[model samples]
Target: MKISNETKVGALAIVGITLLILGFNFLKGNKLFSKSLVIYGTYENIEGLTASNPVIINGFQVGTVGKIEPDPDMRRIQVTFNINEDIRIPNNSIAVIAPNPLNITKVEIKLGNASDYLKNKDTINTVASEGLLDDVMKKVDPVLYQVNKSLGTLDSLISNVNSVVDQKAKRNISDLLANLNQVTASMVQSAASLQSMLAAETGSIAKTMNNVSSITGNMASNNAKISHVISNLDSATGKLAELDLQKTLNTLEGTIKELQAMTAKMNSGNGSIGLLLNDPSLYRNLASTGNKLNLLLDDIRMNPKRYLSISVFGKKKTAEPLMLPQPDTLNAPYIIVDKKNN
Candidate 1:
């Protein structure tokens, strides 16, 4: 057929426009040749979602967003998206706006275990997910607030310190620092002195240590003698341990009791020794008897023929028996003679 240039040009323009439209739609992720399932979701905020953004199932791009419109009645946004008809969406499935590594935001489908599938045009559950930056900001917000509060407190503390640190306080602090310096100097001197005192070849500490070493050496040298002495002591201890101390104590106790009983009897004046110690009349009688015996001894000495008649003439009629002692006179041999007896 013979075609005019105008018709040819018009046909080419139409073909070009059609191709352009198809290409644009293809870039928007719309399937021109295959049927797609349309679904709806309602959200309070879409989070910068727009048309042509990818719809993913387990990270795989399955479709694209179709439209986003606000619903005044519900005061929310209603989103429309299209997915491949071959992909089955459960009635209980969720759609979330998730972040991607490439900084692209997409709709992620979390499939559910519902036995029935969602039909076209049905609404899927939608959830808003926080972006990485949003999560980081959420975590950092409290810490930043605390840091700001701490900075404010530090500023106030500095103000208070500036108010309190007057000239007098400053002078006091300086004096305190000077005293501390002096104390530190003293401590350093003391430490040096202590170091000198502990020197190995000099100092009292060294002399004392040497003496201790000598004494220890002496002790070490006499270790055998010490051991022998210890052995002897141990043997004595063993013998002492074997002694019947209880029986000995009982015997000693009995002796003490007997002595106590004898002492009690003596105190009661019941025994002869007790009478000798406690009776005054008996002592007087003893003195009298001693005096009489002394007088008899004196008479015998003065006149021996009275006590013994040794003459051969029939016992030589004993001299008038001296029945009484002579009177205590100047001539009397025994001055202890009783005048009544005389």
Candidate 2:
């Protein structure tokens, strides 16, 4: 039993065609031999979605999209996707059209907490995830709007400035600039003057510096004398600090209090000295007594024989006592005689 060449060729062609079909279907995400569960979902829009896009569960590929068509109501799109039969899907699970890193759209199944699994051909909830570009636009929209608003504001500000800054303001600004330039030039001149004044040998500043150096040198030469003086001052201060100033002050205070008391007593005319100072009658009496004493002294000097006998020649003549005071004269001695005798 031998096959003909034509039959062999036909068989080979059939086999090749079969392999090619299988390969194309495999590349299109069709599982030829495995059992798969088909599920349905409806979306308002399925812009990047197409058949053969992978269906994922927790980032693992479970199946692929099967078909997409407008619903019977012609209002929304209905998507058919297949998942492995072994991978159970809760009835409340969601199918989201998500973009991968490559920007390829896929069906990402988010499992729900329902205990009941979804049966074949059951509709799952579908959501269209915002693409990267959509998200970027969403975020950038506000920024662009703010930028435009700011530009508008800036333009308004520029217009207002243009209106407010007239020729007079420009002239003022130019005058301010000129003044600033003059001030700058003055500062430069001052700086140059200061530099010249700080010359090493010829400037007044140099002379002052030399004087200061000389003074410092003199001070350095007399440093030992200064130290000695400082030491003496320190010693004096220490001794002064060691003195019993409080006790001295207390003693002085006591003396001052006593003096004050004495002064108060004198002022009050309470003591003998106070009485003598205050009584005019006593003063008058003392003056009278002094005058009488002076007359008695003059009488004694004028008549010494009356008071004492000089010789033993006869009985000493008894001298009469002065009873009146005589008027004082420049040529005669001043005397006071008793009035009765005068």
Candidate 3:
């Protein structure tokens, strides 16, 4: 049967309107076919939260945010959400706006331990969770500060280098490097010469070392003899220590005292040698006596009859005891004159 055009047009318009409404609600994340529960949550601030955002429970998409409006106090924002009817929310559960790994912001219901369930339109507690952007910002702020400080320091260091460096300084630096290279070369040559010198002296050094070793070996071998000699010396010293050193010292002291007394008497002209040394008159008398004795001896030699008369035939006559003239009693001088002068 052919339908009327007007009826067909009206039916088509109604169908189009219905489809448009369904599409609009679908785009808004509304599940038209399933049963759902309505709940509310209030927050002091929502970080870019809007309608059509998904409500999640245990990482599962269970509902969608419905409306965001200011509360009567105007200080708080109230968020209405619709969850699946089958998913029962505990009366004490909290709804938190968290960021997903995909960088999408959503409301996640943190399930609670209350036995009673929240009814439709019941208010759930809410908390503001830090999103990935916030965390990244928190971590990056300090690093950015350090990077800025490093850049500033680098700028200052470059300015200082530019101010201090000049052509003369550069030339001086180059000269210094050259001189350092020369010094290094000289040191290397010196080291090589030292090494060669040491190599050349190695044989003599080894001989000296061998001599030292031989001396040490000889010393080791003669250790017993050395000990014997040392023991003998020790015994001799011990014997010397055992002697009456104090008595010997006392005898020496007495001898010194006697010598000192004798010296004192000699100094005072109390002995024959002292008189001979102290008295010039005694010396003169002795010299005179010596001369007289010499004269007497000469007279006897010259004329034997003066000292002795001998009778060849009759009795020997004893001459008057050869009288030597004393220095004090003699009247004649007894000085002998040189024969040449006479």
Candidate 4:
């Protein structure tokens, strides 16, 4: 057949337009030759979700995202994904949007086991997966709030400190800081001095320590002597313990009582010793007798011729005995005399 050029050009244009439409739809993730199920999901926000994003089932590519747009109310984002018709999805399955390690967005259908399968254009439950960044942001939000609150508190504290610290108080604090520094310096100097002193005395200290060690060694070597002393002490203690101390104390108490009784008797003037100590009549009588004896001895020495009347020739014996002078009556010394001479 003879073909018109206009017809040929029009037919080429139609073929090109059809091919362009098919290519556009294929890029939009519409399966032209394969069967698929269209499912819908709604979210408050979809991050990085676009058409042609793969819909995965257990990490296997099942289909692709068909479209993503705000709903008619513009209040929610509606995502439409096409799943493979061969892959049965239960009516109760959930669709989740997640990110890959490379931060690529993906749609995963969590398959369910309900006997009734999901039909085409059915709405599935949607959940946004908590990615690393999302979790980090969630955790960082509270921390940031706490940090802000802490900063506010710190500001308030600084204001309070400023209000409390006047010029005098600041001066006092400065003085205290200076004094503390001086004390620290003094302590450092003292520590250095002590270190030098210890260094200088190290040999003496070692010698003293050696002497102490030698003394301890000698004590250890003479342990038998120490034991002997301890044994002697123990034996003495045993002997002292065996002694009748109570009986001895009782005897001593009895002796003390007797002495006390004797003292009481003496004090009461009941004994001869007490009478000798307390009475004066016997002493006066002894003093008077001694005086009289002394007088008689003096009289006899002076008047011996009067006291001794003696005859030279033999006189005739008289019947009466010659009388001697009585010392108390005559108050003179007595002497033997011859009767004829008298």
Candidate 5:
């Protein structure tokens, strides 16, 4: 069959138009030559996210991103989107930015449970976040910039190091390695003597360990006797506890209280101790009497015959035996207390 050039051109034109329509329809996420719903959102920054990116919901691609523009305030990016119909979302839900198959940024709608579902034409909350690549690039951009600066500095440092090392060290480097080898060989020879000393100490360690085992065996054999003594001690302590401890304690406490009371009475001039403790006059009198008694004793010691004379009225007639004075009877009216005793 013979074909004209015009038919061939016309046929190719129809095929091209069909493919164009199909591509556009597919990009809009619809059947070839079919209609779709358009949704809108806003963003602060697109961060390399562009149109034709897949719009998704929790990772399910449901739509494609369309025309993106800056808002009137210029602080946010106003995004227009086309989504598949029959996909109702909640009003409380938000839209997130995701990436397409080519790692292209796109809008992904997230649906949270709400009181009422969103209609086909309903607008969603703007919660566009930077896509993974956008976030990664954001983090990497500064690091890359720092790395480039660091690489430049490192290059300068390396050049300096190369200038220093290449000049004279390269020539003597082999000599340094040779000297280090010689020192290592000498160290190995010295280590042999130290190894012999370590081997000699092993026998002493074994002997100490054997002595420790002997001591351990002795303690183990005496363990039962120690336990029996401790048990007997516990029984004796129990029996001791059963004694009239409370009565003894009470008696002790009573004695202590009485003693304290007596001491207090002494302080308040109420007992025999009171006379000695509280009366300064009594102390002074006792001191005076002691001095007088000391003087009388000294006189007697010097002239014993003067006080030992048995003659009456100082008329010494004969040296007779002396008799000691008797104590007064308690019932004899308490005897008009002798001045000396008082």
Candidate 6:
């Protein structure tokens, strides 16, 4: 085959042009010459956002973000995108700037009324948004400042607390622990003594119970004797009840009236008791003789052998006729005097 240099050059140029067109079509999201949709939106910050980025609707890649330009009136960045026409976008749909090329990050929009709506270069008003990392950092600055102030105050308070708990407080805690240990040891030492006291008290209670038991047993054993005593007492009470001693006492009271009659006779000088009761002369004589006898006894006490002794060899004691005091012939009733003066 014969080919000219100009022909080869022209052929090579055409092939290169074809490849460039294909690459352009691919980057423009055309399926080697297929149809798509165009959606538009605006953003306040276009941080790290670029053109030819994928546009997604609810996480599905529908189009690409084409061009970004600052809107003069709103002063916000306007983003234009291209989407498929067959995928009917509602008029209230939104376009977003995603974070990755794999179409990973997404922004959602609820579809609005679409009566044959959304042609090429149609600007879809943005409804809601999520921002890039720089926007989050811009919002975080004041919060970080407040946190830093709070941390400084907290550090100062912690430092003061640490200083107060340093040395003396530690020694006080140690002393408290030592006192607790001593108390525990003393309690341990007294444990046996307390146990012995408890045991002795228990033993005393048991002994008292035993004494009560023995007393009860003795009382039980003596029940027969007690019953016999009760029977004897009953018999004696019955016998006493049957005595009828009231009749005998009434008979004796009747005899006391008769005795009172006799006593009245004696008082009136009527019988043998009345003669003896009325004998004043006899009593006077007897009293005189008793006085003389009393004197004689006094003399005998002074000279016992003159009155009581007798010489048994010749029996020399002789009876003497005593001269009695003659009250019978006395013209007057003589008042007797003590013979001790005589």
- Per-residue lDDT tens digits for candidate 2, residues 137-223, read 999999999999999999999999999999999999999999999999999999998977667546776778999999999999999
* Stretches of model 4 off by over 4 angstroms after superposition: 100-103, 130-132, 139-342
Model 5: lowest-lDDT 10 consecutive positions:
325-334
Q: Give the per-residue lDDT of model 4 (tens digit) for 1-342.
A: 999999999999999999999998788667889888888999876767888888988989899988788978877999988888887888888988887668669988898888998889899999877776878899999999999999999999999999999999999999999999999999999999999999999999999999999999999999999999999999999999999999999999999999999998888877787876676665455555655665555566555544575657865343332233335545643333332433
lDDT of 3 by residue, 114-218 (tens): 999999888998998776878899999999999999999999999999998899999999999999999999999999999999999999999999999999999
TM per prediction: 0.43, 0.44, 0.40, 0.39, 0.49, 0.35
Give the CA lDDT, 0 to 100, for residue 248 in model 6: 94
Candidate 1: the clashing residue pairs are none
- Report the number of the highest-TM-score candidate: 5
TM-score preference between candidates 3 and 5, better one: 5
Q: After superposition, how far is residue 187 of candidate 6 from its true place, in Å?
A: 31
Off by over 4 Å in 5: 1-40, 43-55, 61-94, 97-106, 110-123, 127-151, 166-191, 236-251, 276-342
How well does candidate 1 match the true structure in TM-score terms?
0.43
Q: 1 or 6, which is superior by TM-score?
A: 1
- Give the 10-residue window scoring lowest on summed lDDT in candidate 2: 329-338
Q: Which residue pairs collide in model 3, if any?
A: none
For model 2, the stretches where C-alpha displacement exceeds 4 angstroms are 1-139, 154-202, 297-342
- Candidate 3 lDDT score at position 5: 100
Which parts of model 6 are misplaced by more than 4 Å?
1-4, 42-45, 68-78, 98-117, 127-131, 138-342
The sequence of per-residue lDDT tens digits that candidate 1 reaches over residues 1-342 is 899999999999999999999999999989999999999998887778889999999979999999989977757999999999999998999999886556777899999999999898899999988877888899999999999999999999999999999999999999999999999999999999898766754677678899999999999999999999999999999999999999999999999999999998988889888898888666666766766776676678667987775776565544554445656433644334344543
lDDT of 6: 0.72
Q: lDDT score of model 2?
A: 0.85
Candidate 4 vs candidate 5, TM-score winner = 5
* Of 2 and 4, the candidate ranking higher by lDDT: 2
Clashes of 4: 0
